[model samples]
Target: MPFIDIKVIAGVFTPEEKQKMVEEVSEAVIAVEGEALRPVTHVVITETPSGAWAIGGKALTAEDVQTKRAA
Candidate 1:
């Protein structure tokens, strides 16, 4: 049984993207831990409210993330 936790800024990823993330993450774990753990492999995603995430002392909101991604 493996538990994976992922956190990101809110509104940065669409529901479909999150679903893809969960699927890919689970597959990666299965490849390393074997298929038997498929049912037990857990991938949890947490989203912090906009402007709540920070980097290098700078707070980043959802718009900031989009801006950075575009650049």
Candidate 2:
């Protein structure tokens, strides 16, 4: 069994996008660990409220994450 935990800034990703991520991530794990683990694999996505996530001592918001992704 494998556990994949992901966290992103709140409002940064849509529900559809998250589902896509889950699918692709599961496939990737299956490819490595074998298909038998598919049912046991877990991919968890969590969101941190704006200003609740930080890096380098500075809190970051959804806009900050979007801007960084665009760069």
Candidate 3:
């Protein structure tokens, strides 16, 4: 059996979008592996506040990008 796990940041995708993504991912997995017993796939989405996530130790937000562009 093949097991797949996908983790993505929350809020970026809606429930319906998430479902579609999961389905597509599962199908891709099946395609790679021949039709055997059964395959297991898991998708985990996590949500974080604007300041909770950071890159290079600096938090990034929509406003930050806009401000940088304006400057």
lDDT of 2 by residue, 1-71 (tens): 79999888898898998999999999999999998999999999988999999899999999998898889
Q: Which ranges in model 2 have alpha carbons more than 4 Å from their true place?
A: none
Candidate 1 lDDT by residue in tens digits, 1-71? 79999898999999999999999999998999999999999999999999888899999999999998889
Worst 10 residues of 1 by lDDT: 51-60
Q: Give the TM-score of candidate 2.
A: 0.91
How are the candidates ranked when ordered by TM-score, highest leading?
1, 2, 3
Question: How close to the true structure is residue 54 of candidate 3, measured as C-alpha lDDT?
Answer: 77
Per-candidate clashes come to 0, 0, 0
> Over the stretch 1-71, how does candidate 3's per-residue lDDT look in tens digits?
65556544434556897688778877787777755623454444555555566789998664664466569
The alpha-carbon deviation from the true structure for residue 50 of candidate 1, after best TM-score superposition, in angstroms, is 1.0
Answer with 1 or 3, whichever has the higher TM-score. 1
Error of model 3, residue 63, in angstroms? 8.5
Please give the lDDT score at residue 35 for candidate 3: 54
Model 3: worst 10 consecutive residues (lDDT sum):
37-46
Clashing pairs in model 2, backbone N/Cα/C closer than 3 A = none
Worst 10 residues of 2 by lDDT: 5-14
Question: What's the C-alpha lDDT at position 12 in model 2?
Answer: 89
